[model samples]
Target: MEKTVCELFAGVGGFRCGLNSIKDKDFSLLSETWKTVWFNQWEPGKKNQWAYDCYVKHFGTSLDLNGDDTTNVDISIVDKNAIPNHNLLVGGFPCQDYSVARSLNGEKGIEGKKGVLWWSIWDILKIKKPPFVLLENVDRLLLSPSKQRGRDFGIILSCFYNEDYFVEWRVVNAAEYGEVQRRRRTFIFAYKKNTNFAKSLNLENNNSLISEVLEKKSFFAKCFPIEKLDVFSIRKTTISGDLADISDNFSFDFANSGIMFEGSVYTAKTYPVITKSRTIGEILESKRVAEKYFISNDKLYFTNSDSTHSDETKTELSSEAKKTWQYIKGAKRKYRTASNGHKYIYSEGAIPMVDEWDKPARTMLTSEGSFNRSTHIVRDLLNNKIRILTPKETERIQGFPDDWTATGMPEKFRYFCMGNALVVSLVSRMEKILDKIFSEE
Candidate 1:
């Protein structure tokens, strides 16, 4: 059976491309592996919805593609029955406040300041009741809303539990599994009560359920194999049924990996056994790059006229430029004042200024351009010059086709789209395992 999929928050088809493009034994493309029946992509408060434009341009506009504001457009009002029954529902929901980048605020989590897109997903699950569900979000979701840890994730698990779904999740760093960049995102795979995987969760071995689910039967366990968990390290807890209670008092003790079924969450630490990977240099496109893409020597410095030496204008020292780069990468202690008139010292550890060609590139940020500290800097090995990665290279790092998000829009949005995207290879790996599991059932 050809597995059908409904992609929500489909940012230019990362999940679509990954699932639809299966590889043969010799690495040839297989198109009929999975079909994307329905998809939705919309950016709130943007007059020029480039993300939707790019998606429609690439995948072609159809009735199945909902380009409207998902939050505002009620699915029930607009054709609840219009959504085709799909075998799987997949999405990389917006990770706004769920990210660690946001400072601590007591009033945050599932019902935070931003839109509650999770409720929209929950609504869809209730309507369609897909046998399988796959979702992606920032790893910070494991312990969010600094005041109440794990409340956000707990609400999500409880939603699934209410639907009789058995869920397993792991924080996967794509580079650890041989992907091009080091993008860490939490992936949750759930099986409804009717599925064999879910049925197995009810087996009569109370002591071994967690170990069996994580080490033997879970989808992620099969795709990204992990080291055995120490028996003592395994933690088990019964989550409260009331989300309000969990929201106020939930502890953030979830390990890097875990499973939640019924009302209990079983978790433990696990390590990845990375076998192979591609480095930054392997995805470079020097021959196809334009001269403007490289940072010019003139732009790297400034000139200062010295009265002491009228004949010579002191050129901005390369050391000065290097110092700026060092500051961005190095950690330092500094006294600061908060907006509330409180004073304190702020500090953070530094990262490598330049990404290494021998290793995978660092995770990209929405601001992937010159002067952005989170942007990747590469020293052109051929010319010994430094420059930010091109939009095409950024796409390549996320395993998207070059110019995949290039829909005649400005280049900056391309970076923003890729920054919010999930690694295509990661989705493909999970889809392959999912196909096998579903086929057997």
Candidate 2:
């Protein structure tokens, strides 16, 4: 079996970087076991296209590989038939409302702008029928759109089922699996039923199949070990309908881990086999960060209340900025008015003013540098100052190389890329299992 890959929604090559174990700043060397034949990355409504530029800087454009037009175009407009055939398809597609509707010609069609990207993936599956697929998304995909709890995921399972594939998924928190960040994402691993590994599984009995796959047999189970399966916690359901039908009415309490085969879904909550995770202090920069990252003394101190009026006013401006951040992070209970002219009380709990050093950092958000509750602020032991995480530190949090996104992009976007990236080590851990599966053929 060939180990060619087609990377979709390739955000700064996170999937590619992980698969190839690219620790260096550039892609001068790649893994001999797996090769990426094609990739696509495009950010709509953005002129600069920083992510695509960063990707091209590391890995050359599609035109450089196979004479294809470009890898930096909107995937929705690209023809699926143009994609090269490959043994593996991998990506971290955006999470969106995956509702479906019947077209005017009575064919099932995806509804909404972002939801179409899922169909773009389905289109490739229908056309190329890759032997394997590995994908990542926010953990919320298991239960999306409050009105229809699990409809979105159910539709995805149905699509794979129709294509004669078996899927095993797990919601893994990187921190739980010995990574620095506490980011949680859903990982979907699917293989064609006719594949060598799939045939080896005991698929005749759904009960045994679920237990074996979730506990011992599946690649996900092998890489990220789970606690012993308890039969009572398993939930079984049959997904038997078209995409539109499933979208219109399909809801199940899909657990954090599960398998889907031949339309039969067996899902159950499974705990990770915990390991010691690296702490925020361990990944922080050894050298002192730029002065701009540090909170100035004016911002850190409160203006003296007994000072002269002009002096107090001058100092208050900078001091108020720090106070606002404290107030945002602190508990709040206040009265407010709604848009409909209804008076109400809005309450919120406080979060830590400074992130803990000994523990793995909280999930890094796209707004890491901003003065918000979600941003990570820590006491820089080297400089003896409070500061936001630099771009390199953010990269380390997500298991990327020191300056993976520092290739000519703006500093702020570097944080956004890491916030959107997967833990590279997570994919690196699965490489051996994937290699074994491929070699079996």
Candidate 3:
């Protein structure tokens, strides 16, 4: 049976591409097995809709429905039945404060402003009940909102528990597993209660749930292998209560990795298996790249106004960009005063002037093309010039094909999509696991 998928928060079809890829011998890209039935992509407060345009350009738009906005809680503008039923649901929803408080009616629970999008997903899940769900988020989601450390994640678990789903999660770093970037993200995989995988969670020793999840036979532990876990610290703990109470007092010590089954969550620390890594240089494009992409010495300034340079007003790098490499890559301590009456010391470290080709590149941010401090600068070994990474290079770092975002869209938007996307190779590995489980069924 061909598995159908619906992608929420789909950015340039990264999940779709991985799930569908079917390569021939010699590992060249070929075809796909999985099918995407419907997908939703909307950027709030934007008129251009470049992301959506690029997505539609790459994968033809779905005409099965008139409205597909998940945030429309009312569902009046859109018809629920318009969505095709599928076996899988996948997405990398935005990270936000996931606070759940008692409803004003005092009879129901509601999520925080940004967290309301979750309810949109739940709305579809209740109706469609896809057998499998795959989601991705930042590593910090494990411990969010300093005041209430694990409250957000606790609420997420409770929602799945209420729906009778068993979930396994891991914080995976692409570089650790031989990918091109050092991006770390938390991935969540869930199985409905009646499925074979969920049924197997009915273990003889619930106290050793964490160990069971880390076992060789477990799905995640197999795909992304991990070292032994300290079972005592993270086995068979329950976070139970009305959503409101859990919000007020959730555990502050949520583990980095875990599984939730039958209302109980088992969590522990897990490390990745060391593997070969690809560096920034390996993914660079030279001959095809235009000369304008190269950075000249004069273009490195932070300000266009005629003001004396200070730590606050200087460029990301100095006029002598190459000479400032050390200052850009070293740590410094400085005393400063705030705009108000407060006085304090502000100190921070610097990133490399030129990204190291021997190691994986750092995390790509939305401001990829801008002259921001976090932006990557690489030395063109061929021409002996320094320049920022082009959008195409950014795409390669995330395991996407060259010009994947090129559809008459602006260069900045292309970089933005790659910044928000996951490494496609990571999803490709998960696709194999999904196939194995489905075949067993």
Candidate 4:
């Protein structure tokens, strides 16, 4: 029998896709979907990929109630008896409470709903007892204020330590791995005591171990425009830099030190820093900018002390129009673009930064964070307006193949899908170490 593998919290199967190259030959059974699912009649949970038509079409519909034969099985699911014995388990667990980008709002550890998923993964590991386990998550998981963040991670370590598995972790930036994206995630690897890692586990041996894999080079060295950029343009973007150095008051254990990474050989690009506290919705142009509007009283009044539309009828109309504008603006949210090219403007809180090449991107989400469907974007050499990256662009930034997901899915669906994907170059490197571990020993 081939080595069995399983994926949890599969998220459009990014882990599955990466493992495909391995499982195709060395591995046999693959398990995904959810676990403890006793009956199909219990209904699919939100986390189950089965609700997605695209998932079924790609991975084949799951019929197994849990793991045993109902029909086919979702890679995300498991039933005690149906579960397959696997040599490896890999996945990026969900992270919301542990995410620094979100408001802590009284949450501290794995106690929150999203945070609790870690326990579930741990449970499965306890049951299946795979020889190795790989996990991915936002780097922030290392230190969260509730002390809960640190506690949870510590618990994970203790769990593995007691199970006779050795654990190793490294924070990897996608940019460093080869993709032009500034995405960063933490990789957690665990190996059973008997697994002979040999030189593969030797962090210094990455070069020697990956020579063959990197040789088949077929990626871009640098992203367009970013590779050949004028620093003057960026210099011009500064609104105001303080002359006086501000003293920082807060002290934290893990000081923020980013090591932007880029890939070697093909498919290379500079990682544009993810713009923080901004959004991609600001690229929209404003249409109405009048300093004043009309007002009315009593039976009806209109205009201001200096306006010509002070006439009673004009006043009434202006008042009505202003009110109408408010309603329309509220309904339209940020902007209203008509097919004829007319864009209706609405009131905004502050000018939010839109994602553009000329500018860095907004912060990335763990999985279902904001702007899940849009990428941070800025202008280019041309002055024309642009939209955030579609799913296809996201795939490239994540080091996924151009045809990363099967074609024909709606752009919105794909965008969200790609946003949840991992940076392949980083994870791929981690996987290479595993490959060598098994091959050598």
Candidate 5:
């Protein structure tokens, strides 16, 4: 008594995350069929998206794509009874080329690979012709135009029209809806032309979720006004903190050394060298907090008052610890710096943190890349401890349940999957919608 849904370009189930009881669907037979077809490399430029591999890793039960054991063939290959009978279809198509962030200045049309992915979704819709379809993409898509016609979006208008569907749309921001980050995207809802329903829902409706989701927190929480917030000159500053005592050797500073964000230096006062540095190993206990690590900031402050040095026997630091510090000082001098990112858009600002400890991950990109070089470094404003977020932690950030991708896949592979996944919280609402729709059926 439930509606059937097939997610295309499904990255970690954002479209379906909100739907309860994925167990109700037999997902494996669907995966086997999908794997044989979608993952094949024969088609010209038709291969699985990198994140699709991760999607496959998290299998639904014996349930095929539709959660039905009996109806498991590809839609194009199905007969009348074998095909799923459902009132709705849902998906969030790829949006790289059509994203507002990508085209802040202007938009080129749908020639980009991400733009082309929509055609595949269209192909499925044309073949199956479900009564209703729900889809989402970046707002930039509404404005993409070709010189001949006013906009490529007109093509979408025509596509739905030809399919005998009535289309409606609204622009919504995730931050306004429920997410912490201010992410605005466009959602288009299409229904069979002339179909009867309850009270008519129109385009630009359902904007209540914004306030409903984020009421109290963002209301009184003052946004850090970028214009008014003080910006410091990019002065070349050395990593500072109470360096670990001499007896422990150079290991104390290895993960801790790095440039702190502008004002982070003084704000985080140092705990005692004896107490704080000793506590770090416990803080970094991989098992207790395998997904998090202490990242040191650039500014190192000395808390060792009247602290003696190795050169001077009166120095508080043990001779061995002083010797280790010198090695790091020597290593820092030898370290070669590298460029931040691609020449064009990267110049606007250093890359945002692609990964973080304990917190959810930053957005992922499809590019074959390493995030370590990105602006991923972090210094806890309260504690100067720091390190690059491990790949597993990145998975946690993207809302991939801890270690789901790690147990079976390579760490880099998991990182790629997390990098391409949608924020779980964003997709989680969809799961609830799917459940309500199915329950009524």
Candidate 6:
């Protein structure tokens, strides 16, 4: 079997870059071993489609080896059968309510808008039945929809159970595993029961299977090492029933790490085996940064109080901008009136005015370079000047090549793409285990 891949939600091709070891700034080389047969990228309600444009600019508008088109349309509207079959499927899908309901004909159907994407993935599984699947999502998937905790993830496990696949997941903090950022995400790796690797495991005995697959031999265990599991920390349960039933009634306390096989779930809290971590100071651009990135101390008055001015003339942060950031990051307790005419006290704690260079960076969000409190503000070590991180620095923090998203998008969107991206080195580490599995075939 060839090492073919079908990438879904391919935002600027993070997984592709990692799989092919695309270190060159020009992205000129292609991988001979792992081939991406097809990919789809689409952002709803956006006219520019910057991410899709950047993707096509890097990898040309050519068809895959299987003669399938690299699509930019909404995946929910795409025909599942039209997608080419491949050995592996990978994506970082959005987190949403995974509730299900019975349609007019008594058939199970998706209930919400964003939840439809997961069913699109399920539709592909039902049609193609790919041998392997690797997905990424926010760690909050384990406990979502405040009314009913863990229902969303339980439904996901039940879907895989119905499809005859074994699932293993881990919530990884990149900083804890020697990465540059402190981002935490849930990674799921699933394989079909009929695969050669599944046959090698002791699947009949639950204890033996757990010890072999979840503790030692699984892909996640090999790539991200963890401490030995204490017997009392482990929680086991079985997920049963159709999608609608699971959606309405199923709930479990899913730990940060776990496995699901033949509807049996065994979860536990596992700590990473610490490695040498890289700090924010390590990934800074060695070159001199442009003046626009530096914050200006000059006091400038504006007619309106809105910090985010549409005026392009105001490129650098003014003294007023610094004050706004300080006020947002500072502690505050105030009385406010609700829409119902009730009074209440709102309080929040303070965050450090400047980010520490000695530690890994805080998780980068989509609003990375904005005037928000979560945006990273670092002092340039070379010139000793306060500034926001450059787009190249953000890419380096996420382990992508410099100017990877600099193809044609605006500077703001460039930050948005890196904030949405995953740590490329994490995917690279998992490729080794994927290689071994494919070689067994």
Q: Relative to the unseen true structure, what is the C-alpha lDDT of residue 109 in candidate 5, on a scale of 0 to 100? A: 23
Ranking by lDDT: 2, 6, 3, 1, 4, 5
Best by TM-score: 2
Go through the candidates in order and give the C-alpha RMSD of each one to the true structure. 6.8, 4.3, 4.8, 15.4, 18.4, 5.3
Which parts of model 2 are misplaced by more than 4 Å? Answer: 30-32, 64-66, 107-115, 297-323
Ranking by TM-score: 2, 6, 3, 1, 4, 5
- Candidate 3: misplaced stretches above 4 Å? 22-30, 65-81, 106-115, 201-205, 233-236, 299-335
| Clashing residue pairs in candidate 3 (N, C-alpha, C atoms within 3 angstroms) | 20-32, 22-31
Give per-residue lDDT, candidate 1, residue 222.
93
- What TM-score does prediction 1 earn? 0.84
Q: Each prediction's Cα lDDT score?
A: 0.72, 0.82, 0.73, 0.42, 0.38, 0.81
lDDT of 5 by residue, 182-266 (tens): 3445566666644442113221122232122112111011110011111221112122121111111211111101111111111
Runs of candidate 1 exceeding 4 Å displacement: 22-32, 64-81, 96-114, 200-205, 297-327, 330-335, 340-348
1 against 2, candidate with superior lDDT:
2
**Estimated TM-score for each candidate:** 0.84, 0.92, 0.87, 0.52, 0.50, 0.91
Candidate 2 is scored at a TM of 0.92
Give lDDT: candidate 2, residue 31.
44
**377: Cα error in model 5, Å:** 3.1
The alpha-carbon deviation from the true structure for residue 433 of candidate 5, after best TM-score superposition, in angstroms, is 4.1
| lDDT measured at residue 434 in model 3 versus the true structure, 0 to 100 | 87
lDDT by residue for model 6 (306-345), tens: 3333222224334464456555665555566799999886
